[model samples]
Target chain A: DVKVTQSSRYLVKRTGEKVFLECVQDMDHENMFWYRQDPGLGLRLIYFSYDVKMKEKGDIPEGYSVSREKKERFSLILESASTNQTSMYLCASSLTGSIEQFFGPGTRLTVL
Target chain B: SQQGEEDPQALSIQEGENATMNCSYKTSINNLQWYRQNSGRGLVHLILIRSNEREKHSGRLRVTLDTSKKSSSLLITASRAADTASYFCATDRGGYQKVTFGTGTKLQVIP
Candidate 1:
């Protein structure tokens, strides 16, 4: 089975604080993504990486940024956290152009 | 972004009954996938239907796609408590790399 691991299962950060959520995949997939799921809003992509050090912004990438320093790890960074940023964050990895993705346990982040 | 929209936002059914959820997207896609999420946990992939294909099945789950209509449906036969979860349909235009999720359907299978 493909495994994607998120650095934290739950996190609490104060407003204006910086936060980092990490994800690592064992499948060596070329694509990695980060998303924040809000009630009724579903899951909105924050960022995705196609290769090492390569990234692209998704639908809701305004307050977030991502980094892929290596093939297996991708990180999502919140420059300045806000209460509105509280949501369930998910990490996913997949092969290039493949619809089959493997997901990591979500990180429920609360920004106070 | 570009996530499909699921109909009947929520549904409840007795075990052994069938549950169906619909999803509609705005643009053309190379494939559509269904994923199930339990409570606040991670998502598990259920099935994927290519845009060129019309239908597919896995276990008791059946998925049908209407590319011309830009819509799809998922049916769970003889539903069980384990089938209770939020189901989302993701659309990916063939680079297959850019897949977006839909607002999910919350299903509850009452025993």
Candidate 2:
């Protein structure tokens, strides 16, 4: 089975703090994504990386940014965390041209 | 902007009963995918139907796509409690590696 692991299952941070969420995939997939799921809003893509050092902004990328320095690792960064930034963040990865994405367990971040 | 919209935001059914969810998209797509998410967890891909295909099946799950109508439907036969989850429909637009997800339909199977 494909394994995707997140650095933290839960996190708490104060306003204006910088927060980082990490994701790693064992499948060597070429595509990786970051999403934040809100109630009634489903899962909204924050950012995605097609390959190492390549990044693209998704629909809701204003408050978030991402990094993919290596193929297996993807990281989401919050420049200045706010209470509104609290949400369940998910990381997913898929092979090139594949529609099925394997996802990590998710990190529930609380910005207080 | 969101591309897909799923109908019947929430559903409840008795075990063994069939459950169906509908998704409608706004633009052209290369493919449509169904994903299931257990409470407080990540999503699991259930099925994917290419734009050219009309229908596909995997075990007890059946998926139908109507590209002309920009819509799709997913049906689960002999539903079990384990099938309880939030189902989401995602659309993959041809290039730029863009994919959009719908709000989702929450299904509850009573055993």
Best by TM-score: 2
Candidate 2 lDDT tens digits, B11-102: 99999999999999998999999999999999999999999999999999999999889999999999999999999999997675567899
Candidate 2, residues A33-108: lDDT per residue as tens digits?
A: 9999999898999999999999998888998888899999999999999999999999999988777889999999
Name the weakest run of 10 consecutive residues (lDDT summed) in model 1 chain B.
B91-100
C-alpha TM-scores of all predictions: 0.97, 0.98
Per-model root-mean-square deviation over C-alphas:
1.1, 0.9
lDDT for B33 in candidate 2 is 95
lDDT of 1 by residue, A2-112 (tens): 999999999999999999999999988999999889999999988898999999888889989899999999999999999999999999999875778899999999999
Q: Write the per-residue lDDT of candidate 1 for residues B26-103, one digit (tens) a residue.
A: 998888999999998999999999888999989999999998889999999999999989999998876638888998
Could you tell me the fnat of model 2? 0.67
Clashing pairs in 1: none
Instruction: List ranges where model 2 is wrong by over 4 Å.
Output: none
C-alpha local distance difference test of each model: 0.92, 0.94
